[model samples]
Every structure is written in structure tokens, then in C-alpha cells.
Target: MAIAAASTSSFPHLNHTLFPKCPSLSHHYHFRPLRVPFTVRASSAVVLERDSITQPQVTSKVELFACPVCFEPLIRKGPPGFNLPAIYRSGFKCATCNKTYSSKNIYLDLTITAGTKDYTESQPARTELFRSPLVSFLYERGWRQNFNRSGFPGPDEEFNMAQEFFKPSEGGVLVDVSCGSGLFSRKFAKSGTYSKVVALDFSENMLRQCYDFIKNDDTILATNLALVRADVSRLPFASGSIDAVHAGAALHCWPSPSNAIAEINRILRSGGVFVGTTFLRVSSTTPEILRPFIRQRVSQSYSYFTQEEIEDLCSTCGLINYTSKVQQSFIMFTAQKP
Candidate 1:
């Protein structure tokens, strides 16, 4: 029962969780799972080739990101290589305080800790299961399967809904918080709707998988896409600098959901939107037999929220125009900063 430690630095060494000591990377697994319903095809497709259709303009907007600890703008330093051209994507350091950060593959490591504090020791312990490259491999390979466990709209549908919710017009900056394997971020980047689609996650291995999927496949320019390793509780961005945020099925994983929500509210500009999905508490409509199973499945790391709780959290953050859809255990929400 070795739970996963949560996810690392530079050209800094990778923490164990991010790059767990695995036996080999030789194993191959199919990305699609076997049991998806007929109505839904595998949500993820082959990694498409990079196209310069919608790369973001990096030179004009480097001041968007701030140092997590010092709250100063971060400037690109050193050589370039993470997805974007050398001009836009490179190692980062604080402009004023002079603090520096590193990367694991394309993911710019920003958090001192790989993630926010784990809610319970067991929570991280269970996550340890993800440390193995094999586990990561399986998870990414079968993302659609795990995602479909609740039997709702698939990723493609959710992507469309998110586009409608955020309405990412030109020059908008959208951050995909806790983007696992770039499933949703890639779609947003390719759509060319937003000026930039940043894929931020704490797991180096997860980001590595994303880079592996996209590096040679697509022509997405460096300016349009970025990979950052950061904590949701402590995002590395200036206040009110972001236009929208998306976190799919990731809120329950945060140690401090309240803190994370507040941070999301903090970074969003007035009228900016936050759209994401999560698990909710068992509903009255749920069959009696399944309640125990669901309860047993929820570990300490994952906090199940009710519709009321979700709305409460959003309202407390001063977010308006809140809307959500609940079906059994799955919940999707969109809110706007006032």
C-alpha cells in the first residue's frame, strides 16, 4: 500500500513523485480504454502534428506571470525549449527579487513543494501509486476510461461547453490548472481561440507525458502554448492578470480547496471566468447500494462537494454568474469574478 507521493526542478533534479524511480520506459500501452459506451468514442485522439495556427505572442505578455513566493513578475532567463520558441519559452526567474526556477522537461517548476500540503498522510500515500511510470502510463493511456466512470458527457462535449463558458476571444489568457497530460489544454491551444493556453500541473511525469504526446506531433508554436509546474494554492501569476481558468476533475485533489478557490478568484480579472469539473457528494437520487461503494472510494485527499457547497465557495470568493450541472457524482461549474 505505498501511496503515491505527490509530484519537480530544473536542469533542478526531479522530486521522487514527479520522476519516480521506475524500472523502465519500454512499456507501451494504448491510449484508449476497452469499455467506453458506444455513444462516446475515446476522448483523446492521436497526438496531432504541430501547426502554428494559434501561438500566443510572448514578447508582449511576459509580465503576466509572477513569482509565487515574492509576488513579482517572472522573466524568462536562460535557453528556450519548452514547446514555444526560445523567445517565449525559457527558464524563468523573478524580475525584482532575483529568485530562479527550473524545469522538468517542458514543465516550468514553480512550487517549492510539488503540491499544496496533503490533507491527510494517507492521501499522499495513495497518490504514491501514481509515481510508478507504469501507473502514469496506464492513467494517461486510459484517461478517457477513468474520466467516463461517472457516465456523463465525454471530454469532447466538456471541451465544447468550456469554450462556450469561457468564450476565449483573441488576446485572452487562459490557464489550464492541474492539466493532466494536456488532454484539454491541447484542444484549447489547437483551437486558436485564446492568445495563450498554459498547461500547469505539479507532476513532472504528467507534463513529461504531455510533451511526449505533443512535441513532434503538432505544429503548435511556442508562443501559443506553455507548460508550467505550479501549485494551485500558490499560482505564479500577477493579480487580475488571467482572463479564464479551467481545472477538470482536479479540485478534490487539492489539500486546501478553499485556498485554491480563493487563489483562482485572486488571479482572474474582473469578469473573468473559472470553469472546471469535480466529484460531488452522493445525491439522494443515488441508489442505496452504491452509496457505500462511493464513500469507500473517496479518500482523504479527495473532498466531495455538494452543489450548495460549490455555490457557497464561489459566492464567498465574490464570483457571480455561477452555474453548475450535476449528474450523480460528477459536477461541472462556471463562475465569474466580480
Candidate 2:
């Protein structure tokens, strides 16, 4: 039988007796199976080599999270699963850039500037307002209820409408962008409509509030729900990897709606759905004389868009089949990735 070429470097743990120093014999010479002792040694060496070859496969599962810097799929190490507990225990690292990400508090921080001590940056006032502990604490209490004045159909109705729009994306990954205090993210997880629901926000206090709400509910806590801290304009996921995106009462608060929508388009796969609700600059029934004044006042604080502008922005971002339901200053829009 022909002997396989084996290098000492390849099998450093093997005994040197396996390869006898015989100057007369070539390295590629055929070997005859003579002794049982030699066969046992060769067998053990082969077993070791096989184990070495297959060792990397043990931790080869790619995670849904990607490196914010390079956007490469992260390799997960630790307990496996998509639940909050498992993700919290696990550590993620990008093979391409070798950057590591882990749960800092109760949530995984995937923001571009996650770990800089001296380079902290402040966002616009609209975006930074939610980051305050006081605002985060009051978000679900009474602040959110104030949206009724703007004609936002209550959260229950809004959730139902969003669920209706999200039917096609059932049993897939759904990301709740700008999920302040996880009002709708908790509902999405409890509904069991998606295989995984990511409650993502840029505010640290908001994620803490989300975890606070989730910790008490075993049903939602045991589900495939994850709280992620990330910027909407620079979402931390692989391109074309997400199935659905929801932004509720969040468009006006983004620093740049166009950039945020474009990032949403980049993350969604073909046929994926995007649903969002926001305050419009002016409703169709608004008096023409008061329209400019309302626009000017709202523009100074938040970037509110009209119905036509919302549709135009969606189309310009490469999303198609745009549709909306407008009620006074509130508009809920849906679009699809082509």
C-alpha cells in the first residue's frame, strides 16, 4: 500500500518512531503493514489529524448580528439561541475585521461608536431627548398617550394595523427600529408573528427600560427577542438580511429620515416589508393659511414630512408599492423592497 505523505509539522504530537530515519528510503516510499504497534501509532495520528481538521466546525454558526464597522456576519461563541438570555451570555466577533461585540448591560450595543471613552458624540435634540432617564421612564406612562392629540390611533390599533401589514413577513426576522421603551417590540414578541424580534434603539436608557418591561413577563422573556442599541441611519446588520422593519412614531425624531430609510432598504431582503408611523407636517384638512406656520414650528424641533414627501422619500430610497393611511397629522405608511 502507498504511504501518505505526512509532515512532522502537520502531526507534531505524533511519536517520531512512526517515521524512522532511514537515509536509503525516500519520503514517499510505500509501506507494508507489518507490525500491529506501528499500525496503532499511525491510526492514532490519523485520528488526531481528523480532530484538528474538524475542530473549527464546532463554533461555526453565523449570528444574525453583524459588525457595525465592517457589516460582516459575526461569529458567536457561548450558549446558542436567539433568546435574550442566550444572546446576553454569548460573545460576537467579526472574522473579517476581528472586532468583538458583547452585551454591555441588558442589550447588545452595535452602534458605530459603542466603545469609545473620550470620543462621545451627542445627537440632535430630537434624538437625544429620549436618551434621558426621565424621558425613558415616562415614555410608556403618559408621554406616549399624548400622541392621541396628533391623531395617532392608539397603540393597540396601531399595532393591529402594523400586524395586518406584516402578515407576509410572518415567521421571519422583524426589527423594530427606534423601539423606544419597546412598546411595540414587546407586542411583536408576544404576538409570535416573527421568528425573531429585535428591539433596536440608539438610547441606552430606552433599552434599559425595554429590559425592565421584559424581565417581568416570562412569555416574552423566553421568546426570541433581543434588545440592541444601534443608530437607525447606520443599522448593524448584514445587507439584505432582514425580513421586516417597523418604526412607530419615530420618523420625525430621526436626525435624517432619508438616511434612515435608505439604511432600512439596504437591510431588507427582496419582498421584505417596511411599516412606519409619524406625524405629518400638514394634513389635507389643514387650513392653507395655518399650514406654513405649523410647518415652521415643527421643522425647528423635528423633521416632519407631508404625505407626498413621505411617498417620494420611500420611492427615492428604492422601495416600491408605497401605501399609507392618513388621519389628521398622523400617517402610517407601508412599503416593500423590490
Q: Candidates' lDDT values, in order?
A: 0.65, 0.79
TM-score of each: 0.72, 0.81
Predicted candidate 2 versus true structure: per-residue lDDT over 131-247, tens digit per residue: 999999999999999999889899999999999999889999999999999999999999989989999999999999998888768898889999999999999999998999999
Q: What is the C-alpha RMSD of each candidate to the true structure, in Å?
A: 13.0, 14.5
lDDT of 2: 0.79
Residue range 1-338, candidate 1, lDDT tens digits: 21111111321322221222332321212111122111101111101111224433222324456789876666543222334433122335554564656554446678755333564323253334444566556666775567666744778988998889887434598999988778898988888788778898766677777777776654664447887877788898888889999998887777677888899999999889999788777764788787667645355556777677789998997889999877667788999988
Model 2 stretches with alpha carbons more than 4 Å out: 1-61, 288-299
